[model samples]
Target chain A: MTRRWFLHPHAQVFLSVLLSAASQVLFKKSAPMSADASPFGFAAMSSGWAWLAALATIGSLLAWLYALRFVPLGVAYNLSGALHVIVPLSCWIFLGEKIVAQRWLGIALVLAGVLVTAQSAAKIEETIEKEIEEKP
Target chain B: MSPFAFALIFASIALQVGGQVFFKLAMNQTHAGRTARYVPALAAGVAAMTLSIMLWIGLMSKFPLSQLYPYEGIERVMIVASAALFLREKMTPRLLLGVALICGGLILVTAS
Candidate 1:
């Protein structure tokens, strides 16, 4: 029962976003701001955390592609907005990062926008399918 | 931020959007049984994604993550717009409102 749920396409989308947030946090941790941290340099590649971050990124991309097979790009893409919330929260909890009240408000707005976008995407997809069926 | 910084941000987002669109196109082609076209589409998608990562890494190295992340919201908006344009995805008024709210929120986050 548990295994099947993990294989669900929507579940994959959720997993992808979670992994993406994880990767971002890991990357941020591995690459501290420094004079040698040039734009094109690979200095961070020396860190074990950086490699794990890369692996997470690759895993997220693969999960995303698998989900895309079943979900419309529009819907799946909008759902990814959850990253805005997840990444910030992860940083706060795991890294002892501080988010200001204003940023928290902004995060709330982003969550609302994600819900709105998701609702519209699903409705539009249904209408499009109906239109195609009615055409001929 | 400098104009050049803005340009780099724009470029990174565009490349990522291009990557996603290509991947969707590849999937659509597969479903349509145009399998021969799939390889090129997938290849293009990978190339675009790789370039976007390189650019993103460069941006991350230059700027703080807090300052850089708001641009991710902007990237989502761009991706949705491109999906409508390239993938024949229809955009509704509600979708537009949602995207607007997201952009506004990101702007606020940046301000904060």
Candidate 2:
């Protein structure tokens, strides 16, 4: 095996999720808080946080692409749902945001979903690898 | 949220899903040695992703991160659906159950 442990599919997926969570936080930090937040506007790009958010997004995308080489897009996409939980928790911790009871329950449910999906992903990958091996 | 905002959210999600599917196609093309198709597929992927980010940032300016991020859960469901539709990825029962849980959580998050 190569020394690039981070290039491992699982590691790439984990890195992609972490970077995506960071990107969400930074994008929120960069937001102009204007009522006229048009979807095509460039207002967010004025902030330094926006640049960092862009960088985080690029990193996440590259990692996700790398992971997709080994894992099916379905599995990789499901694995990335971890970002929903991470972003909210990060916002609460670093951005001093509050999570209401209903939102907390929602986040918990999302976490459960991610865990279950990840488990299923492992099984799917195993079966695929086995089928490939058997295909003399 | 206004109807316009809801439309933006749905458009952003669609673009994101399109980006992922295109990127997956590019990767598969690369592995298949179809270099001619890879560049355009990868370019399409990048363009869709860039547009999605722009829309997401715009939406973030109007909504709280906590409230908005849950919408990403919806993308998880959509991507899996698209993967099944476009990529022919099998949708196991466990995967469906997981996605159903995510959708239920999203309804709660967005509803409250």
Candidate 3:
């Protein structure tokens, strides 16, 4: 109900966002290098980013698990959609992936959606708090 | 996509959603200080997630990263629905708007 959401509880959600995006990037990097011939690919396993991807994924899930304690799964998951914007941008910056104008427009829309979702969640929280106060 | 591929994708996403719900229940239990109550939920969550990852890997083997990633956006809708149903969270109009915008934007971004 305070800035505590940003500074404390939801910070874990933010970390989930970053780690999830990073893991996706690592997967992207490793994808091309993965051996195409077999299910058991030492080539993919040997890639450092692939391993990092696995770790980042576990880290993201752990952070998400902790975050689900205080935050509504709806709110946390909606904000996690920020990765729609984050992953491609990270790929563009770090992986030199191409960013066409269309993608940029899509990114803006995704950001707008995130803002709206967050604002909506905050409104819900405030309403709940007001109800609790009135009842008590 | 082939029927098998589509089914795999659907199953993978379903498993991911199920895992998320299990994880949420586990955390909620833990929050109430019933630490022992969370173990089965956590184990189930992990199992669902493992299946999801395996199914996803199978799907990705056939599809381009760009083509398949947008399907993940479906999570926003699934999570919102599940939250409303299970957690009794109120579904506001703005939240729906946001979900629409996100899905639209994701479709746009992933379009090649």
Candidate 2 per-residue lDDT over residues A1-136, each given as its tens digit? 2465555677789999999889888888888578877766587788899899889988998888877767778878777777768877898898888878998888788788878888887766655454434431
Q: Please, what are the lDDT tens digits per residue for candidate 3 over residues A1-136? A: 4533443445777888999899877866765633342322334556788799889999999888877776777777878889988988897898787888887888888888889988876655655455434432
Docking class of 1: medium
Model 3 segments beyond 4 Å from truth? A1-7, A33-43, A124-136
Backbone clashes (count) for model 1:
0
| Local distance difference test, each candidate | 0.79, 0.80, 0.77
TM-score of chain A of 3: 0.77
Query: lDDT per residue, candidate 2, B11-110, as tens digits?
Result: 9999999999999988777666567978998999999988987888788788776566667777887899899999998888877877877777777777
lDDT for residue B88 in candidate 1, whole number 0-100: 81
Weakest lDDT window of 10 consecutive positions for candidate 1 chain B: B26-35
What order do you get sorting by DockQ, best first?
Answer: 2, 1, 3
**Clashes by residue pair, model 2:** none
For every prediction, compared with the true complex, DockQ reads 0.52, 0.61, 0.47
How far in Å is the alpha carbon of B22 misplaced in model 3? 0.8
Better of 1 and 3 by lDDT: 1
Please tell me what DockQ candidate 3 reaches.
0.47
Each candidate: fraction of true contacts kept?
0.47, 0.64, 0.47
Task: Tell me the alpha-carbon RMSD of every candidate.
Answer: 4.2, 3.1, 4.0
**Tens-digit lDDT track for model 1 on B1-112?**
6797788888888889999998888866765656697889889998999888877776777787789988887788778888888888877777777777777778888999
